[model samples]
Target: MTTPPYDGQPQFPPGQPGQYPAGQPGQFQPQGYNPYGQAGQGQGGYGYGYAPPGQLAGWPIRVGASILDSLIISIPPIVGVIVALVIDGDQDELGPGGGIAMVTGFAVGFAVWVWNRLIQQGRTGQSFGKKLTGLRVVHAQSGQLIGLGSNLGREICAQIFNQLCILNVIWPLWDDKQQTWHDKVVNDIVIRL
Candidate 1:
């Protein structure tokens, strides 16, 4: 019997329609075939996956936000001190009323700071400072809001570093990821909105 003539198209083995033949060097794989099984899935941008690099909040903007937040958080306590001084004018010691005023002021300020920075930020990813600065804190990998645990951890780490005189707020200035020590500890990143 005469052998059939060779066709122009290359033949694939049975049951392998789009796969390249085994042992074929330099052969292009079929379109849309991803060996890692991630075909057609794009990397997430913001709020789902990590924001693209180079879009993180810069040090200057973050510093400005910190300053603003500091001023805002200090207002109540300053007012309280003033009121205490007025109430206790010319007194060598602070009376009970003056003490109460000072304590109340400090407590109110502390409560406001905690609410804004911890609770609100945990739920919404933005503190007052972050909101004003158009920045947000998110999971570094997932780009989701950092929850209360992460937020608290971040704050604790920051406080520890601050106590150590390490200047945690300025850490992002020299960090490759633009993350402070607390951010790194919590696997969080601050990104522009």
Candidate 2:
């Protein structure tokens, strides 16, 4: 029997999806076949996992956001520390309240951090500081807000990297995608709204 001429359709065995035919090395690929699993530039700007879309927020703006957030979270704790000191007032030791005010202040500050960084930022893509700066943090691939769990991990990584070296914060200055180490770990990008 004579074989049929190639009609541009992949010849797959029955019960198989339109996958690339196997054992036919260098054969013509099916339409829309992407070995990398992402569409080409014509489809959707190269899809995800390669390049994150949207205009990246500037480093200065990002730093501003960080500073703003830091100040907001620190206010309570600083006030508590100041109050505790004033109460002690040259005493050899802490006053009757001891470190209660300081502890309470830190707790409040931690709560604020959780709410702003993990909860709000995860759900809305913007923490208070980012919102004020007209910026957002989103998944690098999906271009959507990273969830709370991811935000938590990202925050932990950020802390660790920041403690390890100040480069983590400043790395974005010269990065092609402006991603810090924590951002890379979480597969995230910062963009201006």
On TM-score, the leading prediction is: 2
Which parts of model 1 are misplaced by more than 4 Å? 1-50
Model 2 per-residue lDDT tens digits across residues 1-193: 2223122332344224322233233222233433334455533423122222335788999999989999999999999988888877767778667488888889999999999998999888888899999999987655667999999999999999999999999999988667899999998888886
- lDDT at position 104, candidate 1: 93
lDDT by residue for model 1 over 1-193, one digit each (tens)? 2212122223244236433343233222222322224535432211122222225778999888777778888999999999999999879899998999999999999998898888988889888888998888877765567899889888878779878876687788887667888888898888776
Runs of candidate 2 exceeding 4 Å displacement: 1-54
- lDDT of candidate 2 at residue 117, scale 0 to 100: 90
Scanning candidate 1 in windows of ten residues, the lowest lDDT window is 44-53
TM-score for all predictions? 0.72, 0.73
- In model 2, residue pairs whose N, Cα or C atoms come closer than 3 Å (at least 3 residues apart or on different chains), thus clashing, are none
